[model samples]
Target: MNILEIKNLSLAFSVGGRYYEALHNVNLSLKQGEMLAIVGESGCGKTITAMSVLKLLSPNAQITSGNILYKGENILEYSETKMRKIRGKEIALIPQDPLTSLNPLYTIGSQIEEVIKEHQEIEGKQARIIAKEVLDEVQIADSEKRLNSYPHELSGGMRQRVIIAMAIACKSNIIICDEATTALDVTVQAQITELLKEIQRTRNTAFIFISHDFGLVHKTADKTAVMYAGRVIEYANTKELFKNPKHPYTKALINALPDFNSKKLEAIEGQPPSIKEEFNGCSFEPRCTFRKDICKVKVPPCIKSENSDVLCWLYN
Candidate 1:
């Protein structure tokens, strides 16, 4: 069943009395026990899109139009009080940087306990017990000892596990991981991804996994959304996307990955366009290898391809 849904969600940021669109008609959904990965280069509005669900956006940011439906209700219309109730208990965020996301001043136990107390309303002795249990659940060895340890004292991977433990402590129905494993090495990244997949399977938790790593997304995500200049250019099942990418951007991204057989690397030419620039046409027109005259004159509507839903004239 669809647990979270984002439909035609458009957003913009107010900068110096000007509004620049950041997310354009964005749409996404997360099912119970499924990991839906949003993959794109930096500044493509990946993190902001997830933050919109929590209503944790900057004051200057504006949601021009859309409905962020959570379990069939439009959460975009939810008041701050109602959002607070669901923010951590039902939807928790595992932030990108473990190094900076946690407070160095507090012990891991205290931090986890605070979340449990606030969202779950279980404090003191009960919260501490649940905190330790969640730590063990995330496979952090010697959970009791680590509880007293400060964030600075633990390894990157262990700290990340603690963050996951926080969500587990709340028994969150949906977890939004925004580049949660970016700082870790390949081995640790793989481990964290596996841990998340395991959590999804065992807890039946839904996840919105945001990352720029295509390789990791293939390994971790069941479905993938490829964003470009704040739009989802391509979306498909992870397997189908890897096997047959319909969108030009998706194809370029997959081709850019390291291939032992090809022993070659291909870089997507040109940087992504600035959101500040108004786009009557497709934002990717400047960078796209197959840019057509029509691509430069009007934005392409999302077309249904055999393997994926794509926003490009090639599939039109």
Candidate 2:
């Protein structure tokens, strides 16, 4: 069952009295206890799409048309007061930078307990016990002792674990991880990813994992979406997408990954179009190696194949 769905979501920002669309008719859904990874280079609208689901977009960002449905209810129409109740409780965000999300002045335990108290109506000793339990759940060593330390005292990996603990404390149905492991080392990244998988299996929690690392996505995500120029160009089951990538952009991204067996890396030529740049047809036409004349004249519709949906002339 789908826990969250984003239908025809188009988002734009106002710059110098003019509106420039960043996301174009984006459609995606997350199933219960599924890890859906959104992967692309920087500025590919991955983060913005996740932010839209949480109703945490910037003041200048406008959703001209779209419906963010959470549990069959359109949250776009919900008021700010109503959204506040759902934000942390129903949908939690694990940001890219844990330090910025955490407060330095307060102890880690206090911050987590605050969330428990606010959402669950439990306070004092009860809340602290819940907080410690969550910390232990995230595999933080000596959970009770670590709780007394401030955010600054912990290492980058520990800080991220604390953030994950907060999400577990809330028992959120959906966790939006916006490059949550980007700042950690390889070992720590693997640990955090394993922790997420464990949480999903135990709690049946759905996840929207945003990252530029295709290799990481391949390992942790059950399904994957490849975004380019603010649009999802290809989506499929993780194994299927990797075995037979259809879109040129998706193929290029996969080929670019470092392989010890391979001698050289194949990098995609040219840069992705900026959001302000208008595209007459397919935005990736300029950089695509197998571009056809029709690719410049008309946009390709999303075509469903055996195990994937691709937005390119090759598939159409």
Candidate 3:
């Protein structure tokens, strides 16, 4: 069952009195206990799409149309006051930079305990115990002693674990991890990914994992959405998408990954179009190797195949 759904979501940014759309009719859904990975290059609207779910877009960012439905209710209609209740308790965000998300002045335990007190009925020593238990659940060593330390005292991985622990403490049903492991080392990244998988299995929590790394997504995500120029060009089961990618952009991305046997990295020529740039047809037409005259004349509609949905005339 779908825990969260983003339907026909369109968003734009105002710049110097004019608006440029950043997202266009984007659609996504997250199933209970499933990890749905959104992968694309930087500035591909991956982060913006995830941020829209929490209604945490920037001041100038505007949602032009669409609905963000959580548990069959549209959260876009929720007032700030109502959203406040859902933000941390029911839905949690594990940001790219843990330091910025955490308060440097306060002890880690105090911060987490405050969340527990606000979301749950517990307080005082009880809240502290819950905080310590969650930290231990996230595999933080000497959880009691570490709780006394500030955010600056912990390593990058430990700080991320603390953030994850905060979500666990709140008993969040959904976790939005926006490049949560990007700052950590390879070993730490692997550990964090494994921790997320374990949490999903134990708690049956849904996840919206936004990242540019396909390799990481392949390992952790059950389903995958490939975004390009602010649009989801392809979506499919993770293994199916990797084994038989349908979209040209998705194929290029997979080919770009290093392989010992190939001894060659195929780089996609040219750069992705900026949001401000208007596209007459497909946004990726300029960079697409198999581009035809018709591809530059009109945008391709999504075509449903056996195991995937692709946005390209070739599929149509």
Candidate 4:
């Protein structure tokens, strides 16, 4: 069963004198108990898509057109109360920054307990017990003592684990991890990924992981979506995306990753298009090595590939 579906979704924000489109006609689906990674550079709308899923966009941003369906229900139609009920119980978020997400005034245990009590009917003591159990589940040593520690007292990895515990407090069906491991070191990143994989396997929770590195996506994502200039240029199964990247942009990104034996690394040239104006042609055409006349003059429709869908004139 599919947990979420987004069709023809476009998002825009009004700033200064003009409207900037951040996401354009994105179409994707998430199956239950699977990990889907949306990969792109900093300004490529990956974060925008994640915010849309959580309904946490700023007041200046609006959904231009399309539907976001969670379990066959339109999430856009939900009232604030209904959405509040679903936020932590049905769908939870592990935001990009653990430090900011934690409450500075409260202890880690108190915060986690508060989340459980708010979403579930439990006493303070019971909630605390559950919090401790979950903290241990995430591999936090000295769970009982760690509960008393403040956000500033714990290390970065420990704080991140606490955040994860809170996210899974009520056993949410879906979890949105937006650059969840971007702040950690290499060893910590590996540990966190393994912990998340174990949790997903045990609880059957679907994950929407947003990241900029293709190598990390390969480690965690079952399916991959490549975003560029507020649009998805390619999407496919993880193995297929690595084996046969159809779009020129996708090819460049995959080739840019450094190989262990090779001393040289190929980098993609040119910056992403500015969000100041809407473009008629492909946004990636200028940087693409395989640019053609049609690519520069008009945008291409998403074409069906052998194993996935790609938006590029080369396939057309």
Candidate 5:
């Protein structure tokens, strides 16, 4: 069963007096305990899509169409009061920088306990115990002592662990990791990924991991969505997408990754189109190596195949 889903989600941002669409017909589904990774170049609408789930978008952003459903309920229709109930407790976000997410002035224990108090209605000693338990669950060492430490005192990895702890403290079923490991060292990134996998195994938690690292996505994601110029050009099982990428953009991205033995790197020729730009057809046409005359003027419909769903004229 799908725990969360974004169906035909279209969004636009108003700038100076014009509304430019930023996401186009985006469709994705996440099952319980599953990890769905959304990958793309910067400004491909990855973060915008994730933020839409929490309704934490900019004031000028508008949902032009479609629904964001959580557990079969269309959360797009939820009132702010009800949405507050959903955030943190039902769905939590682990942002890119833990330092920015944490309150420097508050002790780690106070921050964690505050979330517990607000969401779980637990107080005082019990809230503190739950906070400590969550910290221990995220594998923070010396959980007891760590509680009294402030955000500034913790290492980058430990601070991230604390952020994750807050999510666990609130018993969030779905955690959106928005480039959550981007600032960490490679070894710490590995540790955080492993910790996330462990949490999934033990708690049956679902995750939406957004990142630009194909190698990391290959290792961690169960399913991967490749976005290009505001659209999901390809989506499939991670193994299949890696082995046989369906969309030209997806293939180019994989080919562009650096090889260990060979010094050669394959880089895509052009930049992604801006939201301000208008496209009558495929947004990737300008840089696609396999572009056809039809691709120049006709938008490619999402063609569903045995192993993948791709928006490309080649699939036709």
Candidate 6:
């Protein structure tokens, strides 16, 4: 089943008396036990898209148009009370920073127990038992001992594990991971990714993994979406997208990857445009190497391929 569906979603934030769109016509879907990665440079609307799905956008931000459906219901129509139930119970989010997400005053066990107690009918002792099991599942050494330890007492990796434990405590159907491993070392990042994959296998949890690291996405995601200037320029299966990127933006991203076989790395030129208003032309045209006159004058519809889709005049 499709756990989440986003169709033509756009988000804008009012800044200095003007509204700037952060995400434009973004469409994405997630199936059970599947992982999809949204990758782009900073301020490319990667995190904005995730935040919109969780309805945690900033006070100045608002959804202009489109629908965000979760479990076949339109979540955009949900009230604050209804959205609260969906936030941690049905749709869980593992934020990038563990220190910021965890409470310094609370022990790991207490934190996890609180989550379980909120949704499940389990009481104090039972919640603690469930918390320990989840902590052990994430491969935290000495789960019992670590449970009583506060977030500040644990190492970076252990703290991340605790965050993951709390996220999965309610067995949410969908997990939105926004740069979840950015603060960890490479080795620890790999371990966390592996743990997430294992959890997905065992529980059939769907994942929307957001990251700036293309290499990490290659290891974790089944499909990849390339975002540019608040819009998705290309999307495809991970292997297919890496092997053959049709859009100029997607091509540049792949070429920029540091490879052992290649000495020089090709970088994309120019900056993403400010979205104070919608642009009639392609947003990526300014930075795209293969941009033509048509690309500068008109927006291109997403052209379908056998294994992918690209929004570029070059494809037309």
Q: 1 or 3, which is superior by lDDT?
A: 3
lDDT string for model 2 (69-147, tens) is: 9999999999999999999888999998998889999999999999999999896999999999999999999998988
Candidate 1 local lDDT, 23-132, one digit each (tens) = 99998888988899999998999999999999999999999999999999999889999999998779989887876668899999999999888886675999989988
Tens-digit lDDT track of model 3 for 96-143: 999888999999999999999998899699999999899999999999
lDDT against the true structure, each candidate: 0.91, 0.92, 0.93, 0.88, 0.93, 0.87
Which stretches of model 3 miss by more than 4 angstroms?
Answer: 259-263
**How do all models score by TM-score?**
0.96, 0.98, 0.98, 0.97, 0.98, 0.96
In candidate 3 the C-alpha lDDT for residue 20 amounts to 97
lDDT of 1 at 87: 89
Q: What is the lDDT of residue 110 in candidate 4?
A: 93
lDDT string, candidate 6, 1-316, tens digits: 6878999999889999888878889988889999999999888899889988889888999899999988888999999999999888888888898888889999999999999999889999999999999999899989999889998899888888887787788988888889999989999899999999998899989999999998888889999999988888898999889888788887777788885128578877777776664677998877777778888789998888899878888877
Q: Every model's Cα RMSD, please?
A: 1.5, 1.1, 1.1, 1.4, 1.3, 1.4
Model 1 lDDT at residue 99:
63
Candidate 3, number of clashes: 0
The candidate 4 region of ten consecutive residues with least summed lDDT is: 257-266
TM-score of structure candidate 4: 0.97
* Candidate 5 residue-wise lDDT, 1-316, digit = tens: 8999999999999999999999999999999999999999999999999999999999999999999989999999999999999998899999998988888999999999999999976879999999989999999999999999999998999999999999988889999999999999999999999999998889999999999998899999999999998899999999999989989888888887774215466789989999999988999999999999999899999999888999999989
lDDT of 1 at 47: 90
| Collision count for each candidate, in order | 0, 0, 0, 0, 0, 0
